[model samples]
Structure formats: structure tokens, C-alpha cells
Target chain A: QQQVKQSPQSLIVQKGGISIINCAYENTAFDYFPWYQQFPGKGPALLIAIRPDVSEKKEGRFTISFNKSAKQFSLHIMDSQPGDSATYFCAARPTDSWGKLQFGAGTQVVVTP
Target chain B: DAMVIQNPRYQVTQFGKPVTLSCSQTLNHNVMYWYQQKSSQAPKLLFHYYDKDFNNEADTPDNFQSRRPNTSFCFLDIRSPGLGDAAMYLCATSSPLGTSGYTFGSGTRLTVV
Candidate 1:
């Protein structure tokens, strides 16, 4: 019953390396896709988001690559740093759902020196 | 400076005891949502309030309830705490007219004994 599915439950990467996390959804009604980053004992913060009209959106080192036809999207973190180490969640919201978000299983990313 | 605030960062309650978590927002958003996140898992939506109208997820337990007495405040009440119910409760807010994304509070970690 999970609407959104994410891969690579956990990953480790060296500093300055690239870290990628992928997510997919089966529902076409989802129009808004957002990625959240969470640190231990804190709330998930919005890192970046994208609408279906655009194929990709980038904010600094964080990028979200989306494919509408394929029903898939991925997050890429360039120049991964220790500060970026945390749990990442991909979420989708349906157009008519009144802002309700369905989240993926989440991925734990670790950056090593 | 607008943000969502959750009180009682940590709570421990005996089994079968009732507990309530509070959330407040200064952003004056039109929507407020409560989510439950277990260890190393994605958050699950429990319910939401849209300008005083309550919407509950079908899978949410009967023991859980929510109230939004006013625009700035929302409360989550657990009628009876159980060991299985221990988790982090997160509160988030967003404006229906904007696409900026939600702002989340730090969350309340509940431990059942």
C-alpha cells in the first residue's frame, strides 16, 4: 500500500563524491514531488521540490531529476559532505488530495571523510 | 522567523495512560498535519486540519485523535498509550495557495513503558 517506493535503504560515500537516491510512484495523480532531509532528533526539512511540468530542479548541491512518463524521480547530491549525512525521504502529493503527502521508505546517507 | 513549534520534545508514559502533544505555528498556514514516524522509517500521516475541517487517514487508529481549536494551534491526543504506539510525532504546516512546501516542527518523541 506504499504509494511511493525508494531504493538503497542505506548508503555510504566519500566526501566530495556524488550520492544518488532513487524513488518511484505508481499514481499519476501525484503532481508535487518534494525531498526532505532529516537529522537525528530533529524534524525533516524541505531540501528541494519539483512540479511535474519540469524535468529537473536544482538548488545548489541538491538536484531532483524527475521523469513523468516513467513515474520515477531521483535525488543527486554533488560534492557530498559530512553535513549532508542524514536520512532522506521522497514524497508525493496528489492534485486533489488537499495537500496530503505520501512518503517513501526513506534512505540513510552517510558521508565519510 | 515563521515556523512550526512542537512542545515537550520528549515524553515517557505508562501503558494505557493518555497523552497529548501540542503544536503551534506562526506562519498562519491554512493546513496543518500530524505524522507518526517509527524508528528508521518514513513518516505516516495520521490526519490533518484545513482551516478547522478535520481529515483523518483511514488507517489511523481509533485511539488517536486530533483537534484544531484555532488556526495557530493543533493537538494530538492518544486515548491510550501502548508499547507499539511509541514513535516520533511530527507536525507540519503549509499554505494551500502556495507551492513552497511544508514547514515541520522538531517533533515529539514518545516513549511508552
Candidate 2:
């Protein structure tokens, strides 16, 4: 079973626009939600993350809005730039399982100038 | 900077050939994980080691095996490569002490010819 589902297999946004990606999960055990950005031929790097305790967390232009009761979370990139164009993935880890992370399918984002 | 390192950024192996991929960490984290990511797909966990204790995913193929002799190093041994095995292998490390998430290596792209 796919524990996490992500929408919009691909996205295109103008430079300086807000690029948003969403993810939903069915596992209530998941307490940690993290977003990762991956360029071609590279590994996924942690972009932003949020715990169930917070409704929103922002760092720089990247923000993660998490809703525990709804079992949903989203990543928002403010003023998305060409540099932000890459594949993004959402992952969740259960508090009981420290090392196991369940990942979403992924979204390919492109920023056009 | 302290980080996860995967060797042989690109590897090509013939069908039925045995191959091994290596990973090392400078972060000295307690947990190490191996993930297989196919093109445009989410990364799937194959196995992990929490300080020498190997944990394999229930669905992972038997042809895949992993070993961690020490904290600094881990190895993934594919007893026999198949065409379908071609993918990017990522190694990641994390400290159980905090919820900061994992540090991932650049990844090794494996091509089974």
C-alpha cells in the first residue's frame, strides 16, 4: 500500500511565483513530515520539515504546513526561482520507527523565467 | 563538512554479475540506510543498520544484502544483477538523538547491462 500520496506529477511556475505541492497520508503513526529536493543525478536533500505539533514552519523561502488531524501536509516555495526547479519528494517517519521513512511518488517542478 | 559519502557515482554491471556498493559517513551517526530510487519514482528503502544491527525491508529481494562492519562503513551486495535492478542507490545517515532527519549522499547510479 502506498502510505503517502502526492499530487501533480509535474508543475510549472513563473519565476517569483509561489509554487505549492501537497501530500496526504493515512498513517496516523507518522509524526514527522519532511520535504526533500533532488536534482538530477543527485540524492534528495532535506529542504524543510515539520512535526505534528506545528501547523506551519517556515525557513527562508521554503515553508511546510502540516495538519495532524487531517493527515496532510504541503510545501510552499515563495518566490520560486529557476534554482528551485527540481524533483521534490515528501516523506514521513513514524515516531516508533526511527529509521524507516515512507516517501511520496514525487513531483517535478519547473520554474520558467 | 561532516556528511554521508557514496563511492563510484556511476556503476555498470553485466546481467548475473555480482556487484557491491560502498558507503561511508563522517557524521558518525548511529543509523545508516540504503535506498533504491528508480527514475521518477520515490526512493524505496532496502535496508538499514542501527549500529551494526541489520534491518531489511520485508519486501526487499533476497538478492540484495547489506553489511555494516563498523559505524563508519556500510556495503550493499547484489549477488546477481538483473536489468530491472538498474536504479540510483542512496546512502543516508542519521543520529537517533534528535529529529533533524537524515543526511544523504549524492547516490550511485547503477546500470545493469
Candidate 3:
């Protein structure tokens, strides 16, 4: 019930194209959802996040589209660049837990120029 | 420039040897977490500390232990590391409410030979 399932283990996109990653969770108590980007030899960093109350959230080239009733969410990268190539993980923070983050398996996104 | 910091980016230990990974935070957050990430896998939560209180995952191995002597520093101790223990250990910090996001350190890569 605590798992967050992500799809498309890997993705390949051309420069200036749109890249999308999706995730779904079984826990209904999850209110905070965040996406993290990880480069080689580095820890995952927060990319963007959304709460269940909002249907979408955008930050620069990244956006999060959420569906509360479906228990799913997705990240959209507009004008994808090579520098955006990294492992992206979707995580959900349980409402009851202080800081427990449940992460997906991760998606490796490769943008080809 | 406040962030989480981890020392010794890379560490190598022999089988059955003891190893320790340290993490510190300048964010002065009340929550600290330890996660283990194998290549191409999701980051698995091993434990976390909410202030001085410790919370361990039910599936976390007995060999994995943690210590938080004070608010600024936390440590992950592997009493007897095996080959399967080789992975990247990540340390993260979050505020009391955690509405923002968890800040992760660069992480320590442990190689068990």
C-alpha cells in the first residue's frame, strides 16, 4: 500500500521534444508528491512537487499533472534538453509520517541532441 | 548555501568488515533520513530520525544501524557489510512540517569487495 509505481523504465527523446514520466500510488493518505532528478554520482534533488489539492503544478520547464481520484501523477518536461537527461523518481510523502518518502523505481530519461 | 553534506564520496570495504557513512545538515531541519540505492533501483528507506526519536523500517536488515547523537549529525553503520551491501547511501533532511521538500546530500557510494 505504500508503493509508488512508475512506468517506462527508460525514455529517449529528441531535443526540444516533450518528455513525460508517470507514477501511481496505492496509499490514499499520501498528500505530498514530489519529483526528484538524479545525475550520475549524485543524490536525487527535488525537481518539482504537487499536493493533492491541486490538479497541476509547473516550474519553468517542468510540470506535474496530478489526478487525485485516479491516484496517479505525471511529470512533463517541455523543450527537453540534454542537460535534463537523468534518473527521475516520483515520491509520495505519507501524511502521518514526518518525512517518510516512498519513491518509485525511477525513470532514466535520455535527451538526444 | 545551506544543504546536506556527506563525506567520503566513495568508500570500499572488505566482506564482513565494518563501515560507517556520515551525514550532516546545515539546514537545521528536524528530520533526517537514510536511504540505500542500488544501481538502477529505487532508493530504499532504511531509517529516519525525527529530532532525537529514531524510526526504523520493518524490513531493514539487522546489520544496518544508525546513530544521531545531536541535531546536526547522523551516521549509518554497517556492522558487517556483504557484497550485496554495495550501493549508494543517501542522507536527506527535511523541516518539521516538510511542505517544501527533502534536501539530499551528494551521497556515499559503498563498494563491498
Candidate 4:
């Protein structure tokens, strides 16, 4: 079963617009949430991450809004650029799992110029 | 500057042939992971090694095996390549301390003909 769920399999946005992707999990033991960006023929890179203790975490143009109670989280890319186009994945890791990550279905974001 | 490196970024093998993919990390992280990613899908964990202890996911097929000779090197061996096994194989490393998130190598794209 998919431990984490993500919406909008694919999304297209205009340059300078905002791109938002959402993910949710049912496992309460999950304590770590992370987002990864993958370009064509490349590895997935860690974009941003947030722990349950914080409701939101922002890194430059990337922001992660986490809702513990809702068991949901979302990634917002500010000022989407053409180069930002890639597949984004949301993942959750339970405490004491030895860094085993459960990933959600990825979202393909395309920023058009 | 490449922390994690996967050799033979692309591989083509005949059906039923055995193939091995390699991963090496310069970071010397204690935890190493292997993930299988199909097109437009989330990465599925195949197995991992913490130092020298191998942990296999329950659902991972027996046809897939892994070996970690030391802290810096890990290999994924596919006993028999099938058309269904054609996908991207990703290698990632993380510290057992769990201070930093995973660092992934550019995945190996496997094609079984």
C-alpha cells in the first residue's frame, strides 16, 4: 500500500507563477517529511524538509507547509522558472526506522516561459 | 564534488541476463539504500545496508539482491533481467546519525531487451 499520497500527477505553470504540490500520510509515527526534485536523467535532490514540530519551513524560494493534525503537507515554489521544471516527490520517514523513507507518487511540474 | 556516484548511467541487457549496478559514496555514510523507480512513479525501496548489516524490504523480489562490502561501496544484482524490470535504479546514502537527509546518485537507467 502507498503510505503517502500526492495529488495532481502533473501540473503546468507559467514562469513567475506559483506551483504548489500536496502530499498526505496516514502513519502517525512518521516524524520526518522531505521534498525532492529530480531533473531528467538525474538523481533526486533534497529540496527542503520539515519536522513535525514546525508547521512551516521555508528555504529561499521553496517552502514546506506541514500540518501535523491534518497529516498533510504541501510544497510551494515561489516565482516558478522554466528551469524549475522537474518531478517533485514527497517522502516521510518514521522515527527509529533507520532512515527508511516512504515516498509518495511524484508530481511532474512544468514551468513554461 | 560528487558525493554519491553510480557507474554506467545507462545499461542495456538481454532478457534473462544477469546484471549488476554499482554505487560508491565519497561521503562515507554508514547507511546505503537501493531504490527502483518506474517511469512517472515514486521510488520503491529495494533494500539497504547499515554499515554491514543488510536489511531487505519484505516485498522486494528475491531476484534482486544487494551487497555491501564496506561503508563506501554497495552493489545491486539482478539475478535475471525481465522486461518488467526495466526501470531506473537509484542509490542513496545517509549518515546513521540521521543528521542529514539522503544524498542520491544519478540513477542508472536499466533496459532489458
Worst 10 residues of 3 chain B by lDDT: B93-102
Q: What pairs collide in candidate 3? A: none
TM-score of chain B of each: 0.98, 0.97, 0.98, 0.97
DockQ of structure 3: 0.90
The digit string of per-residue lDDT tens for model 2 on B1-113 reads 99899999999999999999999999989999999999999999999888878898999999999999999999999999999999999999988753778899999999999
lDDT of 3 by residue, A1-113 (tens): 43799988999999999999999999448979999999999999999999999999999999999999999999999999999999999999888875788898999999999
In model 3, the number of clashes is: 0
How many Å off is the CA of A37 in candidate 1? 0.1
Residue-by-residue lDDT tens digits, candidate 2, A1-113: 98899987999999999999999998548878889999999999999889898999999999999887889899999999999999999988877787678899999999999
Clashing residue pairs in candidate 1, if any? none
Fnat value of model 3: 0.94
Root-mean-square deviation per candidate: 1.0, 1.0, 1.0, 1.0
Cα lDDT for residue A49, model 3? 95
The clash tally of candidate 4 reads: 0
Q: Write the per-residue lDDT of candidate 4 for residues B37-71, one digit (tens) a residue.
A: 99988888999898999999999999999999888
Q: How far is candidate 2 from the true structure (C-alpha RMSD, Å)?
A: 1.0
TM-score of chain A of 1: 0.98
Give each candidate's interface RMSD in Å: 1.3, 1.3, 0.8, 0.9
Tell me the TM-score of each prediction against the true structure: 0.97, 0.97, 0.97, 0.97
Residue-wise C-alpha lDDT for candidate 1, range A4-97, written one tens digit per residue:
9998899999999999999999854888999999999999999999999999999999999999999999999999999999999999987877
